[model samples]
Target chain A: MGKNIFRSLLLGLVMVLAIQLVALAADNQFSGVQITVQMQDHSATRAIQKLLPDFEKMTGMKVNLVILPFSAMKEKQLIELASRNATYDVIMLDYRDVAGYGEARWMIDLGQYIKGPLADPNLKLDDFLPTGVQSLTWKNKLYGFPFYIESTMLMYRKDLYDANALKVPENWDELYANALKLNLDTNKDGQVDFYGCTLRGLRAVGYNDYIYNGFLKSFGGSYFDDKWKPIFNNENGMKALETYIKILKDCGPPSVATFGYEEVMQEMMQNKTAQVIDATMLGTWLEDPEKSQVAGKNGYAMVPKGTVQRGNSFFGMGLGIPVFSKNPDAAYKFIEWATSEQVEKSFINEGAFMTRSSVLNTKEFKERWPLFANLIIDSLADANITYTPILPEWREVADFVSIAVSTALIGEKTPKEALDNAAAEVEKVMKKAGYY
Target chain B: MTKTRRDNTPQWILIPTITFILLLTTFPMAYSLYNSVMDTNLLKPYLGSTFIGLGNYFSLLQDGRFWGSVWHTVYITVSTVVIEFLLGLGLALLLNREMAGNRITRTLILIPFMTTPVVIGLIWRFLFNYDLGIINYVFRIFHLPQVLWLSNQSVALKSVVLVDVWQWTPLVALILLAGLQSLPIEPYEASLVDGCTPWQQFRRITLPLLSPSILMVLLIRTMDAIKMYDLIYVLTEGGPGTVTETISYYLYVIGFKLFYTGRAAAGSYILLIIITLISMLFIKLLRGQYQEQP
Candidate 1:
């Protein structure tokens, strides 16, 4: 009796295991092809839901999104690609990640694919705001395709400027002159409650990218020469740092050093600052009265030019394919569809910043988001890819550099001392990681 | 050697406990220790790992960042424990006495202690903001210098410590209060008849009786404080220039952020050793008090 019962139990267990395996197999579409994408969940989980159906319809392939926070997205992409696991077929590689992922043979060389069917006729790759295309390349190989790109522009209260009869400044001298005129302290208050401008100085990578990069670029400071050595503490760099400190201290609110992205956004929304600097992405929310306090009253213009470099900013996310991917053809087709004009139109309609020139010029899109449409194209025109440094170990080095910048801004260390110390530490880390 | 053998009591209890512990604890502990001695990257497999012996440990000893994190962890742990103990004891004494609505007050005290660490951190962060925060608004209205609570490196660590104390002090109070309520009445009566002052009676009779419970609370608090990561992480992110970076936070950034798996393992083992030593010392002290009690 015991032997008979044991045989029956074994048969039941085998049936259950077989059913589970079949369920798992059914969950996978595209049969043998798999792709992974690294994108930020910035607007909750539904950010990617609208585009998935179109991608599937066009290419008949399955995609798996390994969603990450904005803070960790770049670092996660580098680590995952370096392993050559083919863990992701489509990756959201920023300009900073292109150098490392390309050189390491982790990303499939997209030059061959781009010349073929992946290059959509309507979505001309050459027309991708020259600066955006330049950021997606390393040594003639276009490793990534432009997705959403941004350059910082001046966001100001048009009402405040009109009430005070101030023209928007196109240069630093004018900016300072106007800032002084706008520092208003109303109603017998001893303190200056309303400041002219507010910007990020916190110890985070966004602080360095948005605030310090503009200052350095405008001051004629280069991160490295062709030989790759630190040149950021030279005369030009010092002049830039000095100017930044002076402006922030003299015109900014008392707690500017601790202001991060959220704080600056809040301050601008509250109309506490006469002028603020931010990426073009904010234009969508800033123009909506339901979301913004200064909705129609906000003025958009190109970031003012400085001593040498023009008004400078950077590109955002780019798409790349893994070298180990089994179906590079299918993956490239999906990338083409994802960045095509139709998809770009849909995303823009949903309030996402897409980076195809033809899509940005569409009459309907222009009419609906005029403020974003006008300033977005102009800002990208003067964009300099050199301003945002691209190193193989950028994630590690960028953080240390951010800390140094924060210390300088907070008066914990002088600019020269901070940069020198930070550069030395970065060199050491690069050597240890075999980057040099 | 009796004809009727006793049920193997020790063996029955020993077998299940040993099996449970070996599966859950011993295996992971051994695996992590083994990984610490070797240099391996989880992402790469074709490029095989090397056995570095003690190379990772030696490098960590020379790393200034490691020592900085260790010092930060020690400072936070010591400060939190001392403050929590004193404040918790004071509340326990106050609650022990008769008061209006004492039961309601005790229930209210436990509410903060019952909430999760992440919730506590988020609430406190909202309170400490320079703008749109109630604390800052009150300070500004009073003409006081508004503290940049989460921004200034000098003040960020202290702010997190204060949040921790606020959440966990009630736990200590409840434990000490239970101990106070359980003390015998004869000692107090005897001390009063001996003409001892209130301070003397507290020192001579009440404290001696409460030593065991106090020692128990200290041990538990020290262990919990050494492992504090979530609260500090959510509060400041080891920042304002890594001023609040504790040992666990450093390990997390290296392991998960930088993908330095070998280095992170070594750092974690160092933390384990320090915590173990602390626990052992507290247990020894508690054992001494237990033996001294009657």
Candidate 2:
């Protein structure tokens, strides 16, 4: 009778413990709420999705994903998020858009969630690249988690460089010389199949802002002065632009001025160019043999020095939670988990770059892919993390400026004339919009 | 206009229909007009907007890009419709005759017409890519001047026109084919008996008979071509130095991309006026034919 009673009591205790554990897991798992994320295609989406099983196992939270093309995703997400439908629980945002979204109160102020010494003991804020962690903040308030932050650097074909007995260019003059040498008529057909270098000069938003802004910043020209005056037409800015345009003409593909991100990617993939200044995210595609012919034959280097600076590449996108989410607490929990070092390791295992400093410098990751790990970390660390000061007026300013540049490059207008015209139009936009 | 009084029909049906028209059409038109007078940027909705009255319209009048786009729209609309109408009429006549495999040919002709504009634009964009395009491939095959199809500002409009022709010419052919099918065979036989040549018969009798259908096709195509958006948006997005920027493209840039609601509204009102005038002119041209009908 004593043995039977003891056995029954022990069994009951075990069952009670099991039931409590299940209830605790259920509480963390989101109680079956479906959180949708509107994100762009980079290494991050696959990495995040890879963790879904584990997420469900640990928290019981189910994540629904809707990944869109980068351009389409931005337009659709902004329209939906701005209208306050909260259709997306999480969204991918660049530093430039953080201010706009934050000011509009579209994104949750994640300061409280990520504050007080990193919320969760497992997830440390200091583990992230300092700039990347800082980039997600607007008005000194955290609004996003740094997913896969990126900036541009010069990528060249190592095989091509060795075969031609050439060296990496350090400055504009050296770059021009290298470009001339690399612009070889390989088959002596008089038609240049392999161009020296290329950059996106297309009128797309990416080209207009990121690529052109890279050039503008490299020339030591800020969009606005301390008082927010348009400095795009300043002397250093104009000189930088002229040199950039000239170099593009001499070095780039025949129709590069019209090439967008996709076009530049094609040129690099086909090994038709000696070098290209593109986002480090391209390393993922370049390393994939199926995606690139020059896979494993590429070398990474810092972007060439311009007249005013060495390089002025900027960070791209990060994961953000919208403010109108019905389940902010659950969303915050998921974010903390996703941005954790464990998640970063998972991303590295799946061939994705993580913005976390802890994962980026790990001995294991460095051994797997030294150049990629270095390039991403270096760019994110050194990049100009300031959101474009003219972010609010960028949509209109970009179009007007691109038109001017296009005209000048095509020889329809002189650089002076083009810059003057563009400045006039931009000034009018600022005045009408109450910016100036 | 006479309002039809119904006896058996319910007034509620008209009520719903009228409400729908007001909601979908009239309300938007009124809203646009109101927005045109106010300097509202949808992207910055919190900013206190000021009423600018006719300032936006006045500014648009002086805007060079606006005028350039207007000219581009005219060029595209005129060139595409005229060429398509001619080609379409020829195809319609050819199909009207007893020929081998007419059913298959008709179905094949409808394929391009049935494709979504976005898909058509993407397909053509790939086909015309200067670097890795089939059109350039064919050019290499035939030893032709490998034209910079979308890159060269001077020729981008022509490239877009070519795509428009490829897709919409079939529409014209089908409509004209209907008109050709409905025509009496006796008139052609009588003309043949009178020693009239094929060209003469076509010019005198067939053309006169086809006038109503041709006018309808022209008017519809003119309006559509004027409002052209999807294919152009997908293909070039009014790129390569604004060479292919049409009125609709300008409006989209101003409204959606640039968030200049007032300017876009002003642009649409101008477009509305132009379309209305053209419609009136077409109606006047077709008045005599309709007057002699039932």
Candidate 3:
């Protein structure tokens, strides 16, 4: 009787081993495939690195991630993509670049895989934020999938506002008024001892133009018309630029002309400046006790509303398969795994940003980020994807506008004059590009 | 050896070297030359990047911003090279004497020169920062008015010059020191016997003998100053409304940032021409002075 019982136990063990082997075979279809992905260093990418071993194991494929600093990543990606043989199977793309890359035919269109036989049933593409999805779409075809997104918001010193009995600003006028009232000379020096605010005036597309575009859009002005003619010299655009210049020049730090994200964040955190109207991701850093001095003393609000609508400029990053990729199928599989619900949910504590609405709409997410959760969701809804022109010549156009903004702020030219000159130059660029 | 084999040996050996050099330098220069003449905008294929025959060059010539950058480049080059020369000469003369700790101090002064240009730029950028920088903090403590070293349009370029001088004057001084040491003791002995004063001796003998080294310094520094984009990138980024933008920085924006291939190529070729002309002019002037001096 004992010998018969031992035989039965051995038989049960064999049955379990066979069942697990069959499941592994079914799941690991691309057992020999390998793909490379080039990405920028971000919290999300860091989290993905931690979670990457699981992806490689589950898919039974080798994955190589090449992370680089942002500017280097952009330049290196272009160099690789522009070559006949792109080494990276997948690459990170800025939302503004989707149109350029699509037009160049450098990136493979992912719409077919999203809808075709390779499509994962559990992969809810519809769950991504519509703003992100819309930004990634070019000519009605999805060239990429959004990975991280940020929108413009207002961050301010709550303690300072309370001490001065100042209400939170709701619109451009109110923001300007608050800045003026908060502009203090505590030591009675002619120079402002305590600045009211700081705004980035660094002359670059990704620097000053990012902030200035919001004001222009909120005023119902635009860089170009439907026909691609320069329209930012209009009355609304001029007024927006003028107001932006006045606040920057009169109420900010003496070095306000040079302030980028780093300077602005430093000033706000060190309590040298009272407020900054900038990116949504900064809210996390502001509230972190270790990284910020004004941690508990900070307040969050939407970007100030303009006359027609509030200006919430959207910025997003996405991933795409290169056109020259040898392992397109494997590349697609990797990206799918990267953007899946499980991966996005892991970003909750791993990284602070997510592109999916499902991940962002959870009660847990709202509870975790009590300050920015609701504001981010609302701003994402209102975020203007085309706040600045999203064309291939966008860098050139944005540079012109940023320089104009700087000159106007420094009293070298009136806002109207600066905008007009920029408009003329932009017109020349458009005509040269055959946009006429 | 057979004439055929003998002739073929040198040609065969040089073929790879010649081809490599051509590929390294001439090919890109020629390619840029070709691109400069076409309407080669990669982004706008609709325009059909056909042969436009100097359209980019013409536009750049007429471009005010382009001219502004050219002027700024000249200004920065002159300012940096001159300041570096004066300071370097002073340092070199001082170090030429027999003194304690001369060797160690000489080695230590080279520390800045040994650093990578990008790292040097980043370091100076922090020091020159207006709000959080030690420079401003010190000024505050001493009751000195704080100066916006980099943010102010007028002072921005000067601050760039200051950093360049700080990092490079040591190199210039070292180069001149070598020239100083190599100088014959006869000229100083002769001048001493003639009862010539120190200033007169320096002017008549010391300077004329050091002309080669001085020429070397001017040439290297001018070329280097003309290519002064790295510091501007980290410090001012050609900011305060394009007041500090040099030709290299402007072309960088045009080429890498704007991606206007043909226009950027034209701008690059224009810069190459400017650099070559200035270098030629410098060599001619220095050599002329050297030959003409009694």
lDDT tens digits by residue: candidate 1, A390-424: 76666667777777777777676788887887777
Candidate 2 chain B weakest ten by summed lDDT: B40-49
Candidate 3: misplaced stretches above 4 Å? A1-27, A185-191, A350-352, B1-13, B45-48, B285-294
* TM-score of decoy 1: 0.86
**Which candidate gets the maximum DockQ versus the true structure?**
3
Can you write out model 2's per-residue Cα lDDT over A1-436, one digit (the tens) per residue? 9999999999999998886677576775365667887778756787787777788667766678888888788878867865678788888887767777777777888877765543787777777877787777777878788877778888888898899888888876787788777886776867777888887777666674466666777778766677555678888668766876777788888777578877887898898888888887776677788889989999888777777676647664677788788877777777788778887886776664567777888887887777667766666666877535625676677677787667666566777787778788888877776665
Selected candidate, larger TM-score, 1 vs 2: 2
Candidate with the larger TM-score of 2 and 3: 3
Model 3 - which docking category? Answer: acceptable
Models sorted by lDDT, best on top: 3, 2, 1
Q: In candidate 1, which residue ranges exceed 4 Å CA deviation?
A: A1-38, A43-48, A51-68, A72-90, A103-124, A138-143, A321-333, B1-23, B37-53
TM-score for predicted model 2 compared with the true structure: 0.91
Q: What residue runs in model 2 are displaced by over 4 Å at the alpha carbon? A: A1-25, A116-118, A350-352, A387-390, B1-9, B292-294
* Model 1 residue A82 CA deviation in Å: 7.2
lDDT, each prediction: 0.76, 0.79, 0.85
Q: Of 1 and 3, which scores higher on DockQ?
A: 3
Best by lDDT: 3
Look at candidate 3 and tell me the lDDT of residue A36. 89
